[model samples]
Target: NRALYRAKFDAVTARLSATLDTVTPPAGFYLWPKTPVSDTVFARGLLEKTNVAVLPGSYLGREVDGINPGANHVRLALVATLEETLEAADRIADFMAQCYSA
Candidate 1:
């Protein structure tokens, strides 16, 4: 099951790579992407405009010792079907273009 998820995750990341700054997911059903803007802004804007929800990186971990390692990133869960994940990725790319154009 893990291998299957990883394969799907890889396919999603490969498609998103052209627009999003994504690292190869280590494990689990999430993709941790470093967005061009603040994580909160990126997450909110995408959610509001494209209806693609993402978990802000800051929420995944604590600001340990006043240092937030996840401040500029967001998490995208690939727990849905492949088609849904791919569609969400496309929406995210469109949202990013809209945001950067202005």
Candidate 2:
């Protein structure tokens, strides 16, 4: 059910130290995590290395007052099967940990 997806999403973010900034999505399968680095870079690296697709927060917002409020964030949609979602979470956690520790 919905709870399963939310729980998985929460677990992943909790492990990554990535802030889940958006108010619990009212009705969607997305988890928006504030990244430790540029979101675009993070997204690209994730896709290239882990084969996971994440939307850079920059693509979800517009620049205003010389700043794109969406900077340093990425959006993940836990819309796959439970097994796949967990696997993706694991890969993402490792990817982010590596990026941050480097």
- Using Cα atoms with residue i matched to residue i, what is each candidate's TM-score against the true structure? 0.88, 0.80
Candidate 1 structure, TM-score to reference: 0.88
Candidate 1 lDDT over 4-100, as tens digits, reads: 7887788877877877888775767888988888899989999999999999998887898998888889989888887888899889878877776
What lDDT does the true structure give each of the candidates?
0.85, 0.77
Give every collision pair in model 1: none
For model 2, residues 35-66, the per-residue Cα lDDT tens digits are: 77799998999999899999999999999998
Best-performing candidate as measured by lDDT? 1
Give residue 6's lDDT in candidate 2 (0 to 100): 78
Best by TM-score: 1
RMSD of 2: 2.7
lDDT of 1 at 37: 87
Worst lDDT 10-window in candidate 2:
15-24
